[model samples]
Target: MGNRTIIPFGPQHPVLPEPIHLDLVLDDETVVEAIPSIGYIHRGLEKLVEKKDYLQYTYVAERICGICSFMHGMGYCMSVESIMGVEIPERAAFLRTMWAELSRLQSHFLWMGLLADAFGFESLFMHAWRVRERILDIFEQTTGGRVIFSVCDIGGVRKDANAQALDKILSVMDTLEAETKELTQVFLNDSSVKHRTCGLGMLSGQDAIALGAVGPMARASGVDLDMRKLGYAAYGKLSFEPVVETAGDCYARTAVRIREIFQSIDLIRQCVRLMPEGDVIVKVKGNPDGEYFTRLEQPRGEVIYYSKANGTKFLDRVRVRTPTFANIPALLETLKGCTLADVPVLILTIDPCISCTER
Candidate 1:
């Protein structure tokens, strides 16, 4: 073996959007092992359940992660609703599904931009984010808040999209679909992108399963796992398949996310077409007496929310298992045998959200 060196990659780095520290053990320029150290931005949001009432904690849950904020609030609310046996209105369920899919689109777009930036394709990065702004504009028009939408409540959504809003969403989807196809073509077909990503940071399907990879990371490796298939929210009514690629490399992972962007657009359209007419929320009475676990597919991957209540206003505990946390082990596995120069791209492939993981 060549002389070994240790390189630390990010609690803060130019490439990473969130704080995640990894100690990269290297023999010359190739990484031999990657040891992760989390908890840099641990805000102890889960413990806030003790102080915040179950209803009020929905906002707190939304604060867990900005990109997947809607799903975080929705997941927390779903847990409380399940525990209380509060069946939300059908219209509310469809609305939640629409927002969830929109969240996925924005997240995947942001990731594509970051990946483009990592490739040093400045124009491509700007083009990707410019498309993402349209999605955010839709969020602002519908939910009133672009990021931390307080629309999702304990029993159901706090707000409803009117006919005009729904029509606008459909129109926006039509435009975005065309725009995204053109944008993603560069990532999918560009020789430079393929040269940088193809066969790099490979993780076999078996290794991905063993390491507990989730979301695009697992799907890219042909693991065929998607929490949405469990029929949560309006997913049961929606017709779609999880995007998968068997190569289990950086290219495959990128491909999965790229396809998922279009999938999310289709899902939103379905939600609009099948939207029910009724009140958005049901009155949720009384405190939750038992614990319940809710799983939802966040943009990054599967997020599990566990809520325990003691028949009080405040919850006994709120625990969240974020996808980034689950995929860390798999990320370390991929880092091995990769050159130091490829580390940033490899890390971005997992789409790490340390804010979500460390929350």
Candidate 2:
């Protein structure tokens, strides 16, 4: 047998956007096993539910991760709203759906840029992030914040897009669709990109299911599961299908995310065209007295929010099951047999959001 060596990766790596350490067991540059360690940046945000009132905790929830901030706040509010039996207005639901799609767009663009950077395609990375900037601009114009948008509230969203704002959103979407299509073509067609990603980190459908992979990670492995199909937040009213790829490799995951960017654009257009005329928020009275679970399709994957209340403004418990946590097993599975040089790309394929996972 060849001699085995253990190499420590991450917690501070040039490729990783967040901290995630992996002890890679290798035999002559081929990874035989990988051990992951997280929690370097855990902030105990979940435990703050006891100190912060349920209403005031919206801002705290949004701080779980800057990339998925709006969805974090939205998910927490949905859990409390379910416990309180509060039904948001139809217009509010539509607006939430629109904003959620925009969030997805910005996130996928960010991922594309990071992926390009990992592959050493600096120009491609800049182009992808340039497209992302437009989406953030839209967020700032509507919600007053680019990253941690505190607009998502208990009953509904706090902000509404006026007619002019909505028009600008559509105009920007049109421009982005054209620019993003060009940017994604390089990722899809470039020989170098395919060489680095294609056929690397293979995970079968059964293995993905067994490992509890979610979002694009699972979908790329041919497991047809999207939490949006649960009909939460006006998804039932929209017509679309989840993007799936059967290869179960790094390229497949990249392709799934690329297609999802277009899907988000289409969903946003549908929301703008079909938005109803009514209040964006409804009056939510009284504190929650029951335990509830809420699930939503975040950009990374399916995230679950659990809240337990004791009929007081302060919640007894608040817990989040982030997608990065769910996909770690699948990630470890993919790491086996891959060359050490491919480690960063494999990790990026899962789109590891360490902040969200550790929070």
Candidate 3:
């Protein structure tokens, strides 16, 4: 251990946008181990299922994590729908997929900005956020919320975008794609950025799989596991593949997300093209009497939602397994042997969302 000293990194830190405490054991400036501590912002949102009616809990689900609210709500709704034997309208499925891709696009953009900010590239950070605002504008125009969109419901979505609106969304995505290309090139090709990230905090493919990593973290490590491939929602109708990088380092993680942004844009365009004219929501009836487990591919990773009902309006139990929670073990592993200065960027690579983790 070489006379290890302990340092607490978080609960409040400039580089960390969310609150998470890591007890780092350091030997001269190299981190030997990192013990993560969360729960600083647990709101007990899952427990709200006991108090709120099943139909009303979708809103609470959306509040679990602002960055991933739409997916959270969708997961809960999917679980309840599974239990209730409700088949959502075809049009609603396509719309949900479109919105999900939009959410992914916005999330990756936010992560890119945060990563840039962490590396002290202020101009890159600003440019990333500027592009992200266009995605948010599309959300507001269609779903009426920038972050916690209350559009997803049990049987289907509450709002519907007409053909013209869908066309507009596609146009907006094209514009965003054109504007982001130069920024993406700079991130991937710039020598300074490469020097800062290329080999730092490496996790091999086998290690990532053994550590139960998911989403881009696992994908970056060459573990080809995407819950979307399971054909939930309208993803079965779309043609896309998960973005994977074999390097499994900070740079590879960045590359995975950058590629995923373009993938999401392509997915949104496909969903809009395949959208059919029909009702967005079907009538949802009956109490959820059994249990169902639903999985969703959030921007961070795979999120599992479990819902149990005792033949009542209010659900008996709701449990969520967030991506960050699963990634913590991988986070701890990546921290080992890395220099103290690189800790924040390593943490950002997993795209930790403490609100989602602790919820």
| Count of clashing residue pairs in every prediction | 0, 0, 0
Can you rank all candidates by lDDT, best first?
2, 1, 3
Local accuracy of candidate 1 as per-residue lDDT tens digits, 1-359: 88999999888888887888889999999999999888889999988888888888999999999999999999999999999999999999999999999999999999999988887888999999999999999999999998889999988899989999999999999999999999999999999999989999889999988998899999999999999999988899999998989999999999999999999998999999999899999998888999998988998899999989899899899999999999988988888899998888898989988899888
- Measured on C-alpha atoms, candidate 3 has an lDDT of 0.91
What tens digits encode model 3's per-residue C-alpha lDDT throughout 52-162?
A: 999889999899999988999999999999999999999999989988989999899999999998888999999999999999998898988899889999999999987
How many Å off is the CA of 5 in candidate 3? 2.3
What are the lDDT figures for the candidates, one per model? 0.92, 0.92, 0.91
TM-score (all chains, Cα) for each model: 0.98, 0.99, 0.98
RMSD of 3: 1.0
> Which segments of model 2 are wrong by more than 4 Å?
none
Question: All candidates: CA RMSD in angstroms?
Answer: 0.9, 0.8, 1.0
Candidate 1 lDDT for residue 307: 88
For lDDT, the strongest prediction is 2
Q: What is the lDDT of residue 207 in candidate 2?
A: 96
Model 3 clashing-pair count: 0
Q: In model 2, what are the clashing residue pairs, if there are any? A: none
